[model samples]
Target chain A: MTHQRWFTPWLLVAPAAVWLAVFSLWPSLNTVVLAFTNAKPLGGGRFTGVENFARITDDAQLGDALLNSVIYMVVCVPLLTLLPLLLAVLVQRKLPGISFFRTAFYTPVIASAVVVALIWGWVLEERGLVNGLAQQLGVLSGPLPFLTDRWLLLLSAISLTVWKGLGYYMIIYLSALGNVSRELHEAAFVDGAGPVRRFFNVTVPGVRNTMALVSVLISVSALRVFSELYVLSDGTGGPGGQDMSVVMLIQMYSRGFTGHLGYASALSLLLFAVTIGPMLLLLRLNRKAA
Target chain B: MRKGWLIPVAAAAAVLLLSGCGLGGDGGAGEDVDASGEVKGKVTFQTWALQPKFTDYVQGVIDAFEAAYPGTEVEWLDQPGDGYSDKVLSQAAGGSLPDVVNLPPDFVLPLVQQGMLLDIEGADDKLNADYVTGGIDAYRYTGHNGVYAYPWYLNTDVNYWNTELLAKYGLDPAKLPTTVDELIAQARTMKKESGGEVYLMSRKPELGDLANAGVPIMAEDGKSFVFNTPEAAAVLDKYRAAFAEGLMPRDVLTDKYAGNAELFNSGTVAWTTGGGNYITSLATDNPTLAPKVIPSPAMGTPPLYAQGLSVASGSKNLPTAMALARWVTNAENQAAFAHLVNIFPSTKASANDPFFAQSDGTPSGDAKVIAFTSLAQARMLQPVEVTGAMSDIVKQQISLAISGDASSQEALDAAVEQCDKLIGQ
Candidate 1:
């Protein structure tokens, strides 16, 4: 009876295990194998050891893409993680018409990236809202090159990423906030701790695991962001492709025009490794905190 | 949740994912049929922008083809102009290529390299009877030894300038520069006289700058880069200076295919390069600015191309596909197709016809005459002899130079080195 009971648990997990193996694990393994080959767009390719890696090193735009990706992650991760926590705490209170504000904040999460880009593209154009405001205030004479300048374009992309991610992470934090014990806050109140201090000591510590989850999620999204950048800048990546993300460069290589499937696969593996490195660091930090 | 309770959710998740199977593959290669034997089976014909507007005309052509070739069925498909090149190549690789499909000029070399196109030499004599030579040359990406597509329609280069903007600064539109230096001088004068309020250009005249300056972009072999000299550097420097001077739009380096159209129509740019049809679009956007527009001769080798039709080499119904391709591009059909879309036809007979050559007194007519005149010198920018992979590297390097991030000499040297590596590879 005991042996049968143990066997049933394995049988129960077998389906999910097979599902992951076929859909996720196999494709990732295939991609890693392809990084070492002269793969065409389709299936077959010839093995060419380390040639793709050499090409990656020699690629002129690789450095720019990596730097852009790093800048993106740095600007976005903290913004998504903290801003949403603040917003979630604010909206979690029992207030009249609070759901409306919650819905409004969450609207962008459901909107497509292309749609968000189009709306923001208009708002940031020369004659658009920001410039109009500047012109009205007489603080600036000419329109700001919001979408034109390279640094400004990167700023715009990072801002867009933060805005799009705010509501998503807010929902995550809201669920975690529900699990935060009210007794801790009551006990802190009895101890004479102020709202800010109690929040730092109680709410933040209570949601430490959720913070780590949000960090990983936002980091991956920031690293893989392409569509918004592409739609906002029309895919040129701002002048000498200074604002181009690593994934966007990989996309260009994978497109039928460039036909660098092997190189793109190598880029994919590199991106995977890059994504995992930060994730591992986040996990380590999470463990230390625990 | 309990272990037994979680089983339902996991099973459901696994089932949902496993059910999402990918079912995609081609029907198979077509069987051989006698040239004169009764033509049968279906051929899927496609185009980029020839539907809804030309529904009747296209249907008539299909009906005629079907009637002429008994038992043969023509299935027409229309794809959007955006991203058609990528979609076509991916489809070719997926083995689900349309029997006869439109070929974008940029996709021609890539598709040929992938061996997805049919060698249309089987009926070359009939197909080439009175076709435009440049159009035919554009489709022959594999060189004179092979023909991959049937030339269909052209979009000749014509630069439309804002005469109102020019005349406001006491500049004469009739005295437009024919050479690169003169153009740069004109740009400087426009920027200076206008006090930097109005820009002179929005796009970098790549082909024009090189073609007019008499600098060869690539050697005759197309494999070697011969543009690393001072002449190339001068052209790059001139454009870089223009950009630095704020003569061009800020998006000059990154404007996509719909380059600077919105900026020009908004009365910002003084010059915009496009085909004759843009006159209508510009006029539609700004009614008052329509009469102020001046159509000028193309300055460089207008690297416009005739979108053509190609039968996939892996097509099962080659005979039917070839017949449909020929029928679609025959002189009479091409002229009719041109009338529907306001595009330049690629057949000698159609282009030579008075409908395209003769000018009416309207602004649109003047634009057409300039476009037709420029067609005589239009060159396909995709150099046939050069590999597509190498060309991309060259173009990206040129963009870097234009952005002023890389010096002109550095860009050229880098292009040369990369091209050599690509050749060696």
Candidate 2:
């Protein structure tokens, strides 16, 4: 019976294990191997003893890319993780047509990026909705370049990203909000804590785990923010072309379009390091906070 | 029509029928023949972005090919021109490429450098006798003697000005700016005078445009960056000033050429640079602007073969693959396809056809005459082994300069260093 018990669990896990091994583990392992090679342009590649890594030292764009990625994370994470929590709180109340509000908030999350981009592109153009409203409101003298000025374009992109992502993180926080006991809020009320204080003292503490998880998720999303950038910039990273995230840079290099697969592989492994390292660090930081 | 440079036309597939006697003469003579002296089995032919517009015409050619050759099948696959290089690389890696594929020569360089393309030159020399020498030679990689792709059509860039916009900006349509600096100066004055209602350029002008200002991309030996001089920095400074002063739209950094076309037709910007075929688009999308559209001969250098068709390297059916390549690029078909899409046929016969010589005095008609003559002075923009990576590095530095993050001298110096490291110079 004990041996049979092992067989059933092992058999159940086998499919998933095999799936990961084939799709995820093998490619990751291959990427690490490729990182050490010259890997392209006739004869494939040979083991080159860290020449690719050495090239990174001379790469002029790495610093700008890193800076842009960090800026993207900083801009995206708080807007996604924290603002959604506040939104979830407001929409969480039992009220008439609350579901409608929730659905409206979540509609952007459900919308495809293409649709979102089209909407945003029109909304942010010189004569588009946002600028027209501004013009009518007499907030500015003339039409502003919402999608044209580099800095404004970046901000516009950030706004679009946050807008699209808000509902998803809100739903996550809403689920977390559901788990908090009503008794906790009542007890806090009895203790004379105001609504804001009660939120800080009760609901927030309860949803701390969800907050941490959402941070990591948004961080990963920010790190891989190519599609949004692609749509917003019409495929050129805006301004300095520095709007492209680190992963896009990896794709631009790796796809052998440029015949720099070995160097690209090295960059890929570097991406793996950057992505995985932060996730692990976040986990550790959360554990320590707990 | 790429607002961007990501998909430059497939560079090496020019072909001519001559007499149609022995187009693929060396087909059965090559390796991997089955001793039966026949080219057989399923052969896949892939083309880029020919759907809806050229699908029927392409199918017609395929039908003719199948009728002429018994026991042989050619399946055609088509993909859009966007992100084509990435698609080619992924396909190459997976080994899912068609037997005969079309690629712009510059875009095909990475694959060629990998030695993954078959030696087409070794198979057919006589067939290309009447083809443009530049078309045939464009695919010749630096170290390899093998010709990678056969040239097809040329898409020479031309400056299309919105004369209405030019007059609106107080600039004369008769006397256009002949150089990059002059264009920017006129643009700056126009923007300032118009109270910032007009934009001068659609995108940040790069090395190609700067080449018009006499900025060479590389030295005479083609071994290193030639933009190390004061002249180069001065040219870069002009572009940087354009962007900083809001002469060029911010969207130029990201918007595709399609987006730029929208802006141009809307009369938001004064002019754009594109193939002569752009006038046709102006005629269709914005007819009001079509009559106002004035086409100028593309300044600086041009290359032959905006699109090319080539056989895959490790095909089990090379003979069939070569046959399809030759058949599609025959003089008659090339001329017909060129007529359909304004492709410049590389064959002498196709070029000399009365079809090309005639002009109806329309803007498009004049533009065709210009696109035809533009190639006469074009020097093939040869793809060095590390073309993509080198360009990426330089583009980044130039972007930084355009954004005012770095001086032009600093930008060009960085380009030299990074390019040197990549090419091991």
Top DockQ prediction, candidate number: 2
On a 0 to 100 scale, what is the lDDT of residue B98 in model 2? 77
lDDT: worst 10-residue window of model 2 chain B: B12-21
Looking at candidate 1 chain B, the ten consecutive residues that score lowest on lDDT are B20-29
DockQ score of each predicted structure, in the order shown = 0.29, 0.38
Q: TM-score for all predictions?
A: 0.86, 0.85
lDDT of 2 at B285: 83
**Candidate 1: CAPRI quality band:** acceptable
lDDT of 1 by residue, A183-288 (tens): 9999999999999998899999999988988888778778888987887777777766667788887776666653666677899988988889767877777788
**Candidate 1 residue lDDT tens string, B1-425:** 34585789768645543222111221222223233334688889888866676789989999999998889999999887677767776786577999898886566665665566766654556657678788887776533346678888888778788888888875788887766667777888888898877776777645335545667766775566676778888888888887887777666676643466676788887777778788877777898888788788777666665788888777788778888888898888988876655578778777558888777877678888888778888876645444455554566666788878899889878877766654432
lDDT of 2: 0.73
lDDT of 2 by residue, B1-425 (tens): 32333234212111211111112221221232221236677899989888978999999999888989988898888888787776776787677777899987776665665555777777776546867776777766655566777777777777788888788778998988877768888898888878887886767656565565666666655556666567878877878888878887655555544446677888788887767688887778888888999887765665444677877777778888988888888888899887886668877677678766666688788887787888777764433444666766667677777778778888888877877666641
Please report, in order, the local distance difference test score of every candidate based on alpha carbons.
Answer: 0.75, 0.73
Candidate 1 wrong stretches, greater than 4 Å: A1-23, A42-44, A281-290, B1-37, B126-129, B142-144, B205-212, B219-226, B283-288, B339-341, B350-352, B384-396, B415-425
